[model samples]
Target: MYCDVTKEQDIGSLVQSTIRLHGRLGIMFCNAGVLSQSMKTILEFDLSSYEKFFAVNVGEVAASIEYAGQAMVKANSRGSIICKASIAAGLASDRNTDYVMSKSLVVALMRCASSQLAPHVIHVKIISPGPVATSALCATLGMGADDIESMFLRMFRLKNDGVLKVKHVADAAVFLATNSANSPMSNKLEGKVAIVTGGASGIGEATARHFAVHGIRMMVIADIQDELGQKVMESIGSHKCSYKHCDVADEEQVKNLVHSTVQNHGRLDIMFSNAGIVSNTTQTILELDFAEFDRIFAVNARGMGACVKHAARAMVELKIRGSIVCTASTSASSGSERFTDYCVSKHALVGLVNRQANSLGCMGLGLKGVTLDTKHIADAVLFLASQDSDLITGHDLVVDAGFLVR
Candidate 1:
């Protein structure tokens, strides 16, 4: 589709033309983006540079999506519309403050739009990529191909020589637009919703009880242990908490749990994927059993990933910037020895935070804490869910009593 995402006249006309030409709109790619003059950091860049950056990068995208969404609704097509975002907001770089800030704003915009547009059966999504090998990017960096390739490999976890192409972006957009995907509506988080991934005990149980007292309306208490999970929910009272058997290690059940939580609660807002198992003894990688190592990684690393992925998907469908608190540990920073399994996974949890934080931050979402007290973490999440930490995103305040600092 011919789209000029910035100009009101152009956007209006593009939507009008789409209806005239195709009679129906299946998807909208709100993909027009730009960057600003590169600089060392936030301090080096002036306010005017940022203003220009946001104008071209963020304001234009929001305006375009707003215009396109109205057209899609008028055509009566439940379509998936994806926007382009960047991972720079999460990862620190040597320069380009304006670009990073602008990208961060896009994520917040997508999130807010996700909430506003979902009622019309329109899905708002964001495709965030790390560094890509685009000629435009190399030109922007003003560096040779070899130097750029080396830098990218050193900086990013997923490093490829290929410049991030427009097609790579297009492919991601296509996936979100597929009609066969039965994504839960983004508006499902507007009202009260209950969630308890590891609600049977520890931090999960504590968070559950805190939310319960504050008025959660409906809840689904999920845990691997049937009796404990059920009993915890029952203790919380049937009117507020209901138990579900979930082992986040199983990807299939993770999907089922999220769907079931949204179904049971009629809405979902708070998700605490706080379930994790730590090895009692500290063993080096060579000393630990493959089985034992796998067990901890299963529940702590991949398990948390599954829970966040599904919960985030549901939250996006509901058009809500829900609070997600993964149970990372003090060991994440200190590098505990015998606890190699725990340390590795907890460290990786921070990586997950950085990735999604950039996307969500642009959408006015905030992530808080790394290893605070259970009650403190609960309060922090609840505080973030409120208006307190609106500007705080992509941050993990380590509550290890200065262990990491030392």
Candidate 2:
């Protein structure tokens, strides 16, 4: 069936036909845009053209979301809804005034729809990507793929190795569409295979069962405790969950654990690296046993790193953009008076998220000034929340300190 996004009836019919064919709506990706627009500045923007552009770009997105969301709700489907936005929505651009404004409105519409649909247990999200060398973009610029890629790299000030691809965006969409990190109340883990380190007991055991209950295809419970791990796996049923003794502190064991998971399941989607250790000796720094500190670091820091490292390796090698979550503690961020070794190790574990430096065209927390300005944003928010931006509807007030100007 030929579907026109601008026609509400067309979108609605598409949704109805989809449900009729699939028996249930599991995920909906709303994508409609006006790509062949004049790259005009705000001052030169034509109101008539702007209205027509929005009808396809923003209005069509709204229509698709409404129809898809209604279909999911009626079918009692707790699925995911995703929309596409661009980095232009967040930054001020020199041209394409109508395109930028439409994206901004699309973002707001997705947020409002998400809020309204939360009660129905449907998850709504957006994927905002930088310049991608899609065919449309290549045609728009009248440049080939290589030329456009080089232009984007220079325009964005990205590193030599950093190249954005449409596949990266699609991978992100696939992850969000099958979000496994949803609330325990939802069965978003459907058809996922997971490896939970330290899954014998405590938080690991609980999460293992929860994943199994939420429709995980396979749950590999890896832990040092053989008997406990076996019990947890059996209780969850051998069909869904299985046990494997893995001392995360040992690199060989971690490597084999991840390898076997992929070998058995064909793919590994979620890696819950929750394995760690606490202090066994005097927790204070003055009396902290050096040997015990080493033990703690072996498990909490080194072991977790090994797990994440191997899992990441497998995922990247297999072209799987999977999720790897390390269960770090509050001590990872804040200093502690006791369990000093434990705190340090947990901080090392958190290096995956917060580091002094980073790679892949992304930098970690670099300057101390950003930390100091945590409280300063409140003043800017107050101004916007007040009468300051009453006239500036649908505008993103960049708080950057003159960086974009340069």
The per-prediction tally of clashing pairs is 17, 0
- Give Cα-based local distance difference scores for all models: 0.69, 0.69
Which 10 consecutive positions of candidate 1 have the poorest summed lDDT? 180-189
lDDT of 1 by residue, 36-81 (tens): 5455575676887677668778877787788778877887878777
List runs of model 2 lying over 4 Å from the truth.
157-160, 179-406
Q: What lDDT score goes with residue 336 in model 2?
A: 73
Please give the distance, in angstroms, between residue 212's alpha carbon in candidate 1 and its true position after superposition: 1.2
Write down the TM-score for model 1.
Answer: 0.52
